[model samples]
Target chain A: MKTARRNKLKMNAFAWMLLFPSLIFLILFTFYPVAGALKTSFYMADLSTPQPIYIGLDNYKGMMEDDVFWKVFTNNIWFAVGTVPTSILLALLMAVFANKIVRAKGLVRTAFFYPTLIPMIAIGNIWLFIYTPGYGMLSRFLANFGVGDINWLGTQSLVMIAMIIMVVWKEAGYFMLFYLAGLQNISQEMYESAEVDGVPKWKVFWRITFPLLMPTTLFVSIIALTNSFKLVDHLWIMTKGGPDNASNLLLYYVYEMAFKFWDQGMASALTTVMIALLLLIAAIQFFGLDRKIHYR
Target chain B: MTKKISYTLMYAMAIIWLIPLVWTFWTAFRPKKLALSPSITFDFTLANFSHVWQGAPFSTYYLNTLLVVVGIFTVQFLTATMAAFAFARIDFWGKQLVFVLFLAQIMIPADILIFPNYTTLRDLSLLDTKLGIMMPYLASAFGVFLLRQMFKTLPYELDEAARMEGCSLWQILWKIYVPLSRPAYISFGVVSVSYHWNNFLWPLIVTNSVENRLLTVGLAIFAQSFETGAQWSEVTAATIIVIIPLIIAYMLFQRQFMNSFIHSGIK
Candidate 1:
């Protein structure tokens, strides 16, 4: 009994020793920066000046009334509204089709997923060419059918749609992987049972497969939501929030504030708000959406 | 009838997916003047490829990217493995709390950290260096969580056997745990490499000049320089150059890569 206790103690010590380096790194990089950002949000820190002035919620107050901030926020909502459901639905459809078909499954999956492996910056560059007005692929293709060239990235109304198309194209394959996993996890026995009962394929999907895949859906939604927030990388390359800030998302706005305008305080405040929004969404997923879904 | 409909749908979907890629490939290979032509003609040439190779410092970009990626992965692997082992096998007080703190890092959107990380980098005098870009990504919460889950599935008897053979903790990790966790390592490595390879924003913010610029950032600069109008051929050439390695890697390890994404999802 004493030896067992000693062994356990030794194991615990070893574990701590193993974990120490990672813990230190995490503390320095993740926790420290987060805390610093939170703190700096309340202070006006000028790089040229030595001391930070305590602003006491002024930055947050100013952000509340900032038009560009609100514009970016609304644009993000519009972006999410446009992209999320389409990507999810397309992913689900692709997964179902790929799962049901036996022939050329690997090839089909590769074809779908190949675009995803390409860097977003590269995709942005390619799409920029495709979206260019007269001498680009998209315009030329349209002109062949007696249709005139339409400004894709230039128009306010169509720019978000253009971004959404690129986003969905880049992301559907990734989300489909989750759905594929979910589809595989659903036993063949369930489908067979549904068939034996004379249930149609549609009904089987609606009743059995869909409900069972709710956890996967929730998981994918969280990732997709987070991705929607984080996917401003392409916007930097393609739009630069241009045509009078039509394509600006919240994070891009934050980048502009900090990097372009050099308003560190306002940027930090904006970042805090973004963080809060993310947490709220994460909370909703964890508590609300996830709990309502019955898995297994 | 149903089978035919499904086949048709599948083929249609495949074609839709292939269009952009086919366009890209065509633009890359087409003669410079014919790149944006309305009609498809097979006047393929290597001019664009040679132009891109000669015009840009692509070799330097590739080397820098490799160094940053490998450096980040090496540090992250060591740190994550050690942390995961502790979380899985240790009975330390406050373990759960510390683990929760680490998990919280997963939700912290990396963009929010850019300014502070930049400031930190500036303070360290590490800006524009490969190490500067890699430093922030050296400890990955996702990796820690993943390897912890893998370690938990491992039987404790193996540890016991190693201990009986007078193996120290490091020896046991190297001998028993590390070898057993190959799949986990491969999956994590795939995800990590692809992420860092495609990563743009952090590298963009940190690296000021071409000396340290990664491929993604270099591609962005190349794209940005064509402000007046789209240069379809040159841009497509650059895009292909940047993506072909990753595409080839994916093709070679398609199954393993898919499995890695699946494993990441499950974790």
Candidate 2:
């Protein structure tokens, strides 16, 4: 019996040994950097100057007062507001259509999903050409209807709209995959029973399919919200948060502060804020919204 | 009538989703002069394809991308498998807290870590190295969580049977668990490979020279020449070159790719 207990302890030790490398990586790369960023946010670093000055909450105070920061913050909120609901709804619609449709289902699914496979940078580059003036595809296509050329990216009001269009196009298909899975998990018996009860298809969807898909919807929403913030990769390549910072989301603003301006301290503070926001969103989703997801 | 309207709407939406892709393919093959002309009357040709092939070091970028992707995957598979086994099978102190901490890592957008990661790379003297770009991604929290979930669903009898046959833990993992979990591995592998292959921002920041640049970053540089106006044909040609392999892979394994996305979501 003692030997068996010894063997179990040995096995547990070996398991921890197996886990060590990944733990080291997580500590050094993820946790350490996060801690470092938190520390850095309290100091003011100037590249020209030799040392970083310890300024407690000054950066945060400065950010609160900064007009550009407020603009970018509001822009990110608007971006989330614009993107999350639209993309989720579109994804559900597409998934329902794909699920119900019997003909050429694979081909239709592939076509819808193809955009998600394209790299964001490539998408940005393609859309750059599409959004270009007279010589662009959109412009020429519009010309066929005598709408004339409009600079989609150049106008401040339209820049975010253009971004939303690109984002929705890229995201809807990806989210549809989740909804498709949710749809599959809902047994056909439920729908058949509903039909036998003389329930309308729409009502069946509302009462059954929609509730069943609530978990998937919540999961997709969290992912989409995070992605909306994280997807400033395109902004880096295309707009650089321009047309007067109208297209700058939080991540792009952080990128600008860190790399473009070399304000590491301010950048760290911005990153901290972004991280805090993400954590809050994640907490709410997991604790608040996820409880509503019906589990069979 | 309502069904007809909904079907028509679906078709219209699908068509709208497809237009940019169709336009991209058209521009990729269209001759240079015609490709950029912005007129619909232009004739298609293979000139842009040929030009793109001859004008750039696309082969190197492809090789670099493949190397980085395979390298990241190879490391991730091993690390995730081992870590997941520990989390799923082993009883240890602090297991719950450790798992929660690992899950929390998934929420922190990796972009936030770039500055410190850049500094870390600089300290390691690994700047401009493909290995450097792959380093941080080698052990993903997402992978660990995914594989752990998959491992839990596997029957305990398999492990017990292997142990009864005098198999060590590693041997059991190799002979039983790994083989049984092939679907999860494939799904994780597909997602991981595609992500690393299409990764741009980290690769862009780390790789300074042409030697190490992945296809995405290489295409970015090739497409963005600020001195001159954008060249739609050349850019489309480059995008085609970058996307074709993955597109082909997707077509061949369309079902698997869709399954991976589904599994990733539900997990």
Candidate 3:
């Protein structure tokens, strides 16, 4: 009995020894920064205040009044709204298409998914040329059909549309992989029985496939949501949140404030907001959306 | 039939998807003067690729990116393995709470905490180093969690079987759990390697010098071709240079890559 107790103690100590490195790194990088960001948000840490003066609620107040913040926030919302469902729907469609056709399966899947493998910066560089007006690919192609040249990336009203189209192109394939997996998980017997019932292809998809794909959709939605928030790398290449902040995202704004403007307080404030929003999304996924994503 | 229409639609969409890539390849290979020209031409040259290659330190960027990706993933595998072994088999206090806390990394990914993490690296005097670019991601919660799940699914009798031969915990983990968890390792490995390979913002923010820059950031910086006259050829060449390795790898190992993504996602 004493030996068994001693063995347990030995195992306990061994476990801590194993976990020590991970614990230290997790603290320094993840937990500490999150806590540090929250604390820094309350101070006045810009150039005017050389010492990072403590000022409660002032930073938040300033953020509320910052027109740039609201503009970017609105842009971000519109970005999410524009990208999520469209990409999800397109992904589902592509997955079904890829699943159905064997002759062109590999080629079709590669065409859809190859873009997902390319880094966003490269995608930005490629699409920037594609969206350029006058002699650009999209414009020149449209000119073939009697359309006037439009600056896709330079114009304010049209930039969001351009970005959404590019993102859908970039991301739908990634989500399609998940939907394809979901489709495969549906038993062959289910499809065979559906065919025996004389159900149309679209009707079978609507009634059977779509509902069965809810769990995958929910999973893909979380990835897409977080991506919408974090995918500002392309903005650095294409717009820099430009044409007068029309394309600025929260994270990019945070970058401009912290690195460009050296406004640590505002940067921290924005970081805190991003962290909170992410947590809210995480909370919703875990608490709220989990209940709704029913599997067949 | 609906099936025929869907198949045709699929082919059309596939072609639409291929255009940007085709455009890039066409612009890349064609003579520089005809890059944005409104006429069809078959004249091709490799000058743009050679020009872009000479203009940028792509070799250094590739080296730096490869070093950090490998370095980060190597360290992650080590840390995740040890941590996962402990969480899965060893008796430890606050295991559940600690595991939950580790998940904070996932919720607030390193990409989102760019500023704070930059400051953290600066404080460590790690900025501008490959290690700096790698430091924030060395211990991945996702890896640990995935591996822990994999380890748990392993039969307990294997551990007992090894232990009966006077094997240490290391022996049990090495001989039993590690070998059995190859699929999970491969899944997490592909996910981790690809993520770090394509990661931009943190690396961009941390590493400033040419020697320290990764391919994505280097490509972005080298894109000054835009201000010059219709240098889209050179820029697209540079873009292709950065992406071709991954594209080629994908072409070679398509099934393995796709299955890794699918397995990782479902887990």
Candidate 4:
């Protein structure tokens, strides 16, 4: 029994030795920054004020009062609402067709999935050229309908819409893969029986396919939601959070505060807030997943 | 008739999806003078690619990107492997809680913690280096989680048999566990490589100089919105250049990429 205890202790030490590398990194990068950002959020600091003064919650107060903050917050909500559902719907549709289509199956899948592989910077840049006035593809296409002369990225009203459209185009293909996987999990026998039963294709999809894909939908929703928050790369190219802070999402707003403005205090505050929101989203995902295991 | 109509509709949608890419290619190769004519022309040129290639330090950018992606993966594969082995095989102290913290790290990715991570790298004086971009990302929580799950599935008898044959842990892992988990490794490697390759924001934040500039950042700078006649032509070329390798890779390994995405989601 003593030797067994010694062996167990030795095993623990060996395991820890193996885990040392990851543990060091996770503590420094993930755990330390989380704590550091939370601490820094309370201080008053910026590019000018390198030495931060401890001012409890002043940064948060300032953020709450800041009009741009409110604007960007609402804009992000609008962006998420605008983009996620549309992308998911398009993904479902694309998955249906991609899974079913006979001719050009490879072509269909490639067209839908390739954009997801492209960098957001390139996506934004390509779309930037596409939205260029007069000579741009979008302008030219609109001109064919005699509805030209809209400044896509310049106008506050149109900027979010334009960003949303571009993002949806970039993202729908990615979400389609998830839905496609979910579709495959569903037995082919069910579909065969559905065909024999003469139930309409639409009904078969809604009644049979959609219900079974709840888990994927839930999973994809979190990814889409988090992506809506985390995705600020395109903002750098497309609008830089816009003509007048119109297209700014929360992540870009944090970026603007921290990097562009060099307001360390405000950046920290914003970063902490984002960490909170991300945690909240993750909590929702875990709780939803938990319910599946325990209740149903 | 309905089936034909729907197939035609789906095919049309597919073509519509392909247009942006095709248009980018067309604009990229077309003669500089007629890039914006909207009138179809047979005229084309490789000069746009050449001009942009010369105009920016693209070769350095490519090298930097390749280094960062490969460097991050090499470290991640090793670290993730070690951590996963421990988690899967060992009854370590506080394993459950430690794993929960790792999961929390995943919920908020290293990318989002740019502000604090910048400071962390700054304190180390590693900013603007490829290592800075790769540092915080060195130990991937997602990777550790993925590999641990894969490791858990291997039969225990192989491990015991190897141990009986006087194999050390390294030998067992290298000779047995690693070979058996090739599918998982490929899936994770593909996902990680593509993610870091296309990664813009974190690398964008961390690196500043021409020496450390990545493809996406270099392209972002090169493709700035100056209203010159040759803007779209060159911009499309630069864009295409940035995406071409990934596009080629996707074309060759479409099945693997798609399978990785699927398995990653479901698993």
Candidate 5:
């Protein structure tokens, strides 16, 4: 009995030994910082001062009263609303078209998927040229249609639209790959039967194809939703969340507060909200959406 | 007729979609004066490339990015392998709880931890270093989970056979398990490389100086120079410098890359 107990203890030690390095990192970077962020949110840590004054709930209250905070928050929701559906719809269309083509399918797939492979920063930089005021690619293209020069990224009304268009273009190709995989998994027999019934192509897509792609849509929606919050790399390159914070996102605003403004307290509070939002997403995915995603 | 229409539409969309990339190459090869002109002629020159090369220390940026990506991947590979082995093969107390904690970490986006992580780096005196940029990413929950899933799919008989051959636990892991999971490793490696290579926000916040800047940040600094906004050729050339390696690698291993993405997504 003692021998077996000692052997079990030895195995436990060995397992933990292997996990030591990774556990240290997970604790230090993720868990420790999360706790620290939560703690700091309650204390006003003026970096210039030696001691931080404990200011409980003030940071949260400040956010409640801040117009910019509300704007930034709403802008993020709008951004998600703008990018998520459009990208998914475009991806579904792209996948359907790519799936239909019998010739040069590889070439067509490449054209659609290439953007997803490149970095968002590169895409942002490229589109910065395209959105440049005069003599820009976008301007030149519009000018050919006798349209006047419209500052794409400069005007507040059009800035989010510009950001949305660029993001949709970047993300649709990636989401298309998921749809393509889902489309391929769909049984050919079902399509054959539907065709034998002489169903219209749109009805076939709506009734059979669309319903079958529900799991892919759910998966892609979660990804796209996460990305809408996470992807502020483009803002850094293109607008720097400028034109009166018109293009600012929740995470971007957190960054500006933490790094640029150096307000660690408010930043932590903002981060807490971001975490809350992420938790909401997790809840929606696991509880609300996962049941609907069939596992066949 | 429908087939013909689909072909034409697909081809047109494909061409339209690729125009930005094509436009990038076109503008990169053109001279500064003719880059924005409404002409279809290919007045190509390598002058923009030469100018952009000397304009910034791009070579250093490339080296820094290469080192950061490789460094993060190397550390991640080692840590993930060991942790995954324990989780997959070793039965230990609290293993399920520990694994759940790891999954929870995956849900917490790294961006949200920027402040506290920055403070941690500052406290450690590792600020403005490439290690700072690579540190938070070293313990990737995704990597550990990926490797654990991969390891679990293998039969225990392989480990048993290796043990009978007098192989140690470490040897069985590296020799038996690692060799059989090449596809998983390759897929993970490709995903990790692309992720860290193009990673901007974390690296942007961590590194401040030109010496430690990655290619994305370096390109950002170059493009942010408002005076050079009209210097379309040079900006595009700089952009090309940052993205060309990834584009070439993607083109070469297009199948593997796409398959890896597909696999990761479905998983």
Candidate 6:
């Protein structure tokens, strides 16, 4: 009995010893910072000042009242709404067709997925050239249709659309792989049966394939949603969230508030809200979809 | 007939999707005088590459990016392996709670935590260092979770058999656990390396100097130097230089890269 207790104690010690390295880092970078950010969100922190003035909900109030924050928040939602569905649909289309193609499959798949592997900054730069007026590839292409040169990135009305198009192009191939995996996992027997019943291809897809790919869709949606919030890297290169903040996104706005504007309190407040949204979606992804995924 | 149509459509879409990249390559090689021409210029020149090289210290940016990504991956591998072993093999008090908390970290985007992390780094006097850029990512919940899942699938008998020979817990992990989980390590390593290589925003925030800038941040800044209204060829060349290594690596390890991404999704 004593040996059992001692053995348990020893095991516990070993567990802790192994856990310490990761735990220390998690605490330093994640848990501690999150807690600190939460705390700072309630206070007015001036970098020049030695002490932070505790403002108690003022930052939250400021965020609610700030029109730019609302604009950025709504712009992020629009970006997500604009990008996620189209990208997923394009991915599914690619995956379905690519799955059917036997010859040159590797070449086709590589062409689809290659953009995902490149750095977004590089892609953004490439797109910046595409959007450049009066000789840009996109402008020249449009000119061939007798359309006048369109200021793709510079115009307030079109910046977000331009950004969305670039993101969708960059992202669709990535999500296609997930759809491809999900498609491959689906039993061929189901498709065979659907065909035997004289079902049309669209019906086979809509009834059999789409329903089966639900989990992948959910997972990809969660990822794409979070990515919409997290992926402001392109904005730094392309628009700087501008033509009057039309392309401003939540994460970039938080960045602008903190680093560019030097408003840590506001940034923390914004971050707190962003974290809540991410956590909400993550919860939905993990817990909401965990039981529903058909692993076969 | 339907299959033929589908194939034709897929190929057309693929080419269309590839146009930006193809155009980047096209623009990068075009003679400076024909950089903006609608038609492809057959007058390919290395001048754009030379101009790009002269325009920025891209070599330094490459080195800095390599250091930061390697630093993050090395520490992440060690920490994740250790933590994953603990979770997989050891049953102790609060293990579940600790793991849940750790997993919760995965949900909080690192960018959202930037301000506080920046403050923490500043207080530690680690700001402006490559280590600072690497610090927040050193402990990856996804890596820990992935390794733990892989470790759990290994037979307990292997560990017990090693233990019977008087092998310590550490030795058992190093010998049996680590060796068996090579596929997991590779997949995780690919994901981590690609992610850190392409990561821009955090590195942009953390590193202030030209010397400390990673390739992504450097490319952004370089592209923004709008001295010439249409230095498209030079800008594309710089962009290509930043991305070409990854492109080459992906081409070499095409199957492995795709497999890693697919396997990462399985988690």
- DockQ for the candidates, in order: 0.59, 0.61, 0.66, 0.64, 0.62, 0.68
Q: What TM-score does structure 4 among the candidates reach? A: 0.97
lDDT of 1 by residue, B1-267 (tens): 986897798778977887888888888899988865667688979898888887888889999999988998999999999888888877876787887778677788565578777777888899999999988888888998889888889999999998899997788777888889999999899989989999998899899989999999998887777755647788888889888888888888888889988888778
Ordered from best to worst lDDT, the candidate numbers read 3, 5, 6, 4, 2, 1
Q: What are the runs in model 1 whose C-alpha is more than 4 Å off? A: A1-12, A46-51, A291-296, B1-3
Q: Can you write out model 3's per-residue Cα lDDT over B101-181, one digit (the tens) per residue? A: 787888899888888888888898999999898888989888888888889888888878887899999888887888889
lDDT of 2 at B66: 95
- Model 5: per-residue lDDT, tens digit, A1-296? 99999989998998998899998999999888888888989988756645877989999999999999999998999999999999999899899998887778888888888887677888988998889888788887899899999998899989999999989988999999899889989999999999999998889999999999999999999889988989998899888898899999998898999988888899989988888888899888888888755211
Give the top-scoring candidate (DockQ).
Answer: 6
After best superposition, candidate 3 residue A31: deviation in angstroms? 0.6
lDDT of 2: 0.85
TM-score of chain A of each: 0.92, 0.95, 0.96, 0.95, 0.93, 0.95
Per-prediction TM-score of chain B?
0.96, 0.95, 0.95, 0.95, 0.96, 0.96
Candidate 1 vs candidate 5, DockQ winner: 5
lDDT of 4 by residue, A1-296 (tens): 99999988988888888888998999999999999999999999987776889999999999999999999989988999999999998998899889987778898999988888889988887788778776778888899899958888889899999989888988899999999988888998998999999999889988999989878788788789998887888998877887889999898887878888899999899899889988988888777563442100
TM-score of chain A of 5: 0.93
Task: Summarize candidate 3's per-residue lDDT along A1-296 as a digit string, tens digits.
Answer: 99998988888889988888898899988899999899999999988888988999899999999899999999999999999999999999999888878787898999999998889998988888789888778888899899999998889999999999999999999999999899988988888999999998778878898898898999999989999999998999999999999888899999999989999988999999999999999999888887654210
Q: What DockQ would candidate 5 receive versus the native complex? A: 0.62
What is the C-alpha lDDT profile of model 2 across A133-153, one tens digit per residue?
878778888999999789888
Q: Estimated TM-score per prediction?
A: 0.95, 0.96, 0.97, 0.97, 0.96, 0.96
- Runs off by more than 4 Å, candidate 2: A292-296, B36-44, B226-230
The 10-residue segment with the lowest total lDDT in model 2 chain A: A287-296
Q: Every model's Cα RMSD, please?
A: 2.3, 1.9, 1.9, 1.9, 2.0, 1.9
lDDT of 2 by residue, B1-267 (tens): 899999998988888888888888888877766766655775768788777777878889999999999999999899889999998888877787788777767888566678767767888899999989988887788888788888889999988988888999888777778888888898899889888888888898899998898999988888876443457778888899999988999999899899987897677
CA lDDT of each prediction against the hidden true structure: 0.84, 0.85, 0.88, 0.86, 0.88, 0.87
Better of 1 and 6 by TM-score: 6
In angstroms, the error of model 5 at B104 is: 1.7
Any residue pairs clashing in model 2, and if so which?
A: none
